[model samples]
Target: MKRIQFQETGRICQVPINDIFGFMYLATFIYFLPVTGIIFIYIAILKYTKRSLIIANVRQLGLEQTRYRRELRFIKRILILISIIFITGVPYLTFFLQVNIGQSPMPSYGHRISFMFLSCGQGLVMLLAIFYADDVRKSLRNILLQKLPWIRGRRIGNIIS
Candidate 1:
């Protein structure tokens, strides 16, 4: 019967510092893994390609310009994956924490806090992934343009001989 507001203006509950810290630390750690994965993916590409990292990176960027429907499909898949991970992990974590850690005398909202942090962390990863994809698309587009300048317009049109 109680409704929790997603945003609020005043203090509603008190939480223990350790629980809060646990939430933040765990969330940040999980978030870092995927980010590290993305970075390593780039590094691996650079090593294998034996090309300028800058050029290679730009080449990847052009994937974004694909028609809108494909982009939307990719975005939907990423979001669904993010949601599934959070929904599955958060409840399991909450149960584990409650069972092992014991609820506070004041009635713990620790799970809620932890979920907030986790969701934020997951959101960060999803957002970064989207940006990385777009960067790859743009970079590829740029590389193509550089290699074939005439795709957009005449090399030297109206002004001279």
Candidate 2:
């Protein structure tokens, strides 16, 4: 097995990849995990309340209902995506916290699996948004059509038809 040497203590330790990532999980749990959860809650409440306010004012203020609704929906989707990402990271945080506090032994594969899920959460949410939100789908489609020649022709043909 591979090992890392420490000069200060005159000792060499064979730290597995899981142990290395376990430290990262602990660090994230101590530092940013709570912050992420708090921000998720804050944004969720703010967005939904703001959406309600907009709905209440639409009739009296003669706001453009369709535009407001679409914007609100987009905001809601973004909040949901953020919440999902934060939730996915919670298990890793809990596992690391337990290990750090000596409540449980170091997890063999759970840390790596949770880390993978946490890392991919943002990209997964974005992909889901592309399918869930009309605005995102249209924007991505337009960008792809502009940058790729073959896709452009096919998309244009489909649009025309």
Candidate 3:
């Protein structure tokens, strides 16, 4: 049997598959479960309590209402983005738990694809930020146009000059 090497100690430890599964189950139950629960609770508090408070205060701000409303909208967009990230992350977590704790065998391709999906979650958050914020979109457009002038065609050159 091929032994798994420990990276930190550079030691080759012969650990049984069943023991590994038990360790994973305990780790996930003790660590990941509580952490995930806490995050969801925090998000719920932000969405229900803090959001309403901000909206109420923004309403009473009179002259600054427009600015405050815009800021609030941006914050709401960020919250939504966070929620999407958490929702998407559940699948990766589920797959990880199922494979590690449940001792269910996953195909190589399935593992690779699950990892890829998890990696892409951050990219999705960035995309949400870019798409939701007009200021960011404009800034990105300007930077892209400056770096790759050909993207804007002749009209952009004329405008720039």
Candidate 4:
């Protein structure tokens, strides 16, 4: 097997390739398996929701005017979260595979930056969820205003968005 070793700040990281069961192959598969499942489940939910709503003729009810709108908003938020995770994770995947496959040498800082971005992906998702909830967002905004009263007249809500 081809093995790569790199050291930074008194720490060394190694990756081994050249076989189907290599570190790169196994790690990438394990990491991406959940992503694949999330996308699959999202699609299934979208299809089920749309089919059921349409069959029920929600538009004719004269009361559920926001049914599709609400459903789409919920689904769109989920899609955004998934996209954030995948997009942020791509950099590390590329860097790892490129190095392990011998296409390029991994720059010491590249992997670190990629890992930071990947780690922050979940944080971004959490922030999105928190800000999207009406009560939480309002409470947070109020707390911010209370803590920093100078920016009261300005667009504090815009910052949360």
Give all TM-scores, in the order shown: 0.28, 0.50, 0.48, 0.70
lDDT of 4 by residue, 1-161 (tens): 45555555325565533233666466668667877888898899899777867766845755444676777787898899899988887887777687667767667577577768978997998899887897897888889889989988888767864
**Candidate 2 lDDT by residue in tens digits, 1-161:** 33433323323343323365655665578537865775777677677667767676856554555655666776676677767877877877677666666666655665566667777875787677667866766776777677776765465635522
Give per-model CA RMSD.
Answer: 14.5, 7.8, 7.7, 3.9
Each prediction's number of clashing residue pairs: 14, 0, 0, 0
Location of the lowest summed lDDT over 10 successive residues in candidate 2: 7-16
Per TM-score, the best of the predicted structures is 4
lDDT of 1 at 155: 36
Clashes of 1: 14
Candidate 4 or 3, higher lDDT? 4
Q: Can you rank all candidates by TM-score, best first?
A: 4, 2, 3, 1
**TM-score: model 4 vs. ground truth:** 0.70
Across 51-141, the per-residue lDDT of candidate 3 in tens digits comes to 6666767566674566556656765776676676676667656766776778887444554465467568768877876666677666766
Q: lDDT score, residue 151, model 4? A: 85
Better of 2 and 4 by lDDT: 4
Q: lDDT score, residue 156, model 3?
A: 59
What TM-score should be assigned to candidate 2?
0.50
lDDT for 49 in candidate 4 is: 74
Against the reference, the lDDT scores of all candidates come to 0.52, 0.63, 0.61, 0.74
Better of 2 and 3 by TM-score: 2
Relative to the true structure, candidate 1 reaches a TM of 0.28
